[model samples]
Target: MTVVLALEKVTKSFGPVEVLHGVDLALHTGEVHALIGENGAGKSTIMKILGGYLAPTTGRVLLDGAPVTYHSGPEGEAQGVVVIHQEFNLAADLTVAGNIFLGREITRGLGLDHAAMRAATAELLARLDTSIRPEALIRDLSVPDRQMVEIAKALSRKARVLIMDEPSAALTHREVEALYAQVDRLRAEGVALMFCSHRLDEVSRLADRITVLRDGSVVQRSLRGEMTEDGMAAAMVGRELTDIFPPKDTTTGETLLEVRGLNVQNLVKDVSLTLHKGEVLGIAGLVGSGRTELAEGIVGLRPATGEIRIGGRQVQIRSPRDARAAGLAYLTEDRKEAGLLLDKNLPVNLTLSALDMWGFRIDPKREKAEMTRARKEFDIRAASDEMRTGALSGGNQQKLLLAKTMLTGPEIVIIDEPTRGIDIGTKQQIYHFVRALARQGKAVIVISSELPEVIGLSDRVLVMRMGRIAGEVEGAAITEENIVRLAMGLDREEEPA
Candidate 1:
């Protein structure tokens, strides 16, 4: 195998602070090289350097055993290098075909060739086994569909070197299978692929070579057979992660929140549930299974006809303000878009929800004081408090969201996708935080797509399928097998004819 892309003695610095410290990496053709690290561990910086989105402060980018310089990402793409960013880079108003062929349009005669582009886009989407239409606008698609589009766009570039960041983070189990097939095909075709994922299982299954980075430096490098999953985890965080979940609270107290006959448009139908003090309840479901919709309805983010009782008193919560007044807080699943003000500073975002408590005059000193406390409490690592909230790593952003939600001082909290797209180390922190909330006698409801997370965190699991609650599992019964059976309707299928 030959090295197609190489970074030699690379060091990257942002203003006064240095992020990457004398890093070395190599990508070979016909191989999947996995770059595993904790969030903000310089993995993205490395990817950007290789794909020509950013230049190294000091070092060389070698192509075919010789040094080369690409002034821009497009220039690198011209040399068969493509990058699929973690944050999507598509025009929301454009059609799927339009986005795929945005910079390089297929022209015929005088104007744009709409038919030809649509046909080509359809073929590319078909390769990924996705049903997204080429004519559909980007804004009309789901997160998983958007992810598939990014992959299809990269494929359309005829990339020789593809760098993917968290490609499977938003996808469902079926979509992941489809993606795996494409990865295998690409590997067979001699494409050098470098992917970064928090899922160590994915890296173990797909990677031919593994490099673990901790705090901007490569800590360990190994071949497929040389490393175990536990070993990789330990190397990434520099500690033993044998116990990821906190111990489940055995004693649940009196019912604190109750919902009866809840209907959220047509997405959720007659869903009824209860949350008791000192209990962490998990909701597990497939995509479009109405798990999020049910949460939204309960929190008044969505219109619903239901009976919601808090502390044995029926309350009318037609909006988020009403919900907050009724002692409830909801953490949205889409953290980047809905949960945080990315362009604003940390202090502004952290206190956005609880601004009413600081009186109408708006005190900046109080906000800064609270942000300092939040940083220490939530373990939100960052270079400076003045930087944009968007610059924080995924784990830090999630922690900030948790802190913001907690500041509302609600007794009942609903967190959706609590640890999505974060490192294993951070996942442990989040799990413990959820348990800590439970131990404080606060009723918590956690909704997640990962079965293992649901099983580990929830004292009781509610499995939702197509706008309805399929079943519930508790204690020893809350296994992945039981939850999946409910989510997939396998239990119903197994019933007597």
Candidate 2:
């Protein structure tokens, strides 16, 4: 393998906070070097330095053993370097081919080379074995296809140094496999890749070498033969995850909520289920399979036609406010988008949902007391309850979301991707919390894309596929293979007698 790029003594700081401290890495041709760490562990910072988006305070970046400084955008682009962030830079109004050649359009004298750009994009998509039509508008494309378009755009730039951040974050398992195949192909073609991801298993499967960063410094650099998924995770967080999902006691109580003929577009179609008090009902599915949608619809976040009974009393929930008034709290999947008030203080978020329902409260002392207790109960680590929720880490943010909902004292709680973007230790904490809610006689519904989490947490698993209940498996009967098979509509077994 040929050494394509190198980072030496790369130190970076913003104001008084240093993000990277003498981080070193080397990427050889045909290499898939994975950089992984906690959310704020400087993975993105290092990538930005390499891609010329940000300059390091002190460092030497080398290409072919020769020191090369990256100062401006054109400099990195000219040297076969491109960085693809999780937030795709595609224009939704533009056509797919148009997005691929956005600023650097092929021109014919005074006009654009529309025919050539389309052809090139088509060729790139074909090479990646993607089914995205180059002529299709970006708005019409699915999330995975949009990602493919992003990859196509990077490839069109003649990129040899490709940095993909959380590339499979929104991808289904099958889409992830497709992406892995393309990454492998790109590697074989001598493209040096540094992929940053939270998915440790994916890094272990695809990366030729693994670099784990902890607190902005290199903790471990394991070669192909040395890295295991568990080892990578251990090195990344500097601790062993004894119980990713702590064991749960599954003795369920009385039925606290019941649903009948639940129908919602793109999410649920005639979905019927019952969530018992002191029991967890998990909705499991692949990405885009209506797991999150069902949760949102039931919580009145979307247009829905359904029968929901809380504690055997029928209630109509038209909106989120109505849902909360009816004793239902929903924790949305994307915390930044739906689950949090980033600008608000932690105490405010925790008490906001319950203030109207519980009684109009202007008592700062009581609110602070409640927030302090819940924070400790949920292990929400931050500077203070007065601190902005946005300033907290992913795990702390998730815990805060949970704390906010628990403060509502709802009879039914719906959590979508409860542990997403959180660490394993935090995940276990969340698992314990959900189980405790059931034990406290709250009807709990957990919607998760992760099969293990759903199976592990559920008293009964309801598998959703294409806006319908695919299958319902008893909690004890849940296995990854069965859950996936049922989720994909492969099983034709009768619903629990």
Best by lDDT: 1
TM-score of 2: 0.87
> TM per model?
0.98, 0.87
lDDT of 2 at 69: 82
Pairs clashing within candidate 1: none
lDDT at 19, model 1 = 94
State which candidate has the highest TM-score.
Answer: 1
How well is each residue in 150-210 modelled by candidate 2, as lDDT tens digits?
Answer: 8778878878888887787667677777788888888989999999887778887888898
Query: In model 2, which runs have C-alpha deviations exceeding 4 angstroms?
Result: 72-75, 92-95, 108-146, 340-377, 380-393, 493-497
Tens digits of per-residue lDDT for model 1 on 1-497?
98999999999999999999999999999999999999989899999999999999999999988999999999999999999999899999999999999989999998999999999999999988889999999999888899999999999999999999999999999889999898999999999999999998999899999999999999999999899999999999999997799988558999999999999999999999999999999999999999999999998899999899999999999988898888899999889989999999898888888876555456888888899999999999988999999999999999999999999899999999998899999999999999999999999999998888999999999999999999999999999899999999998855586
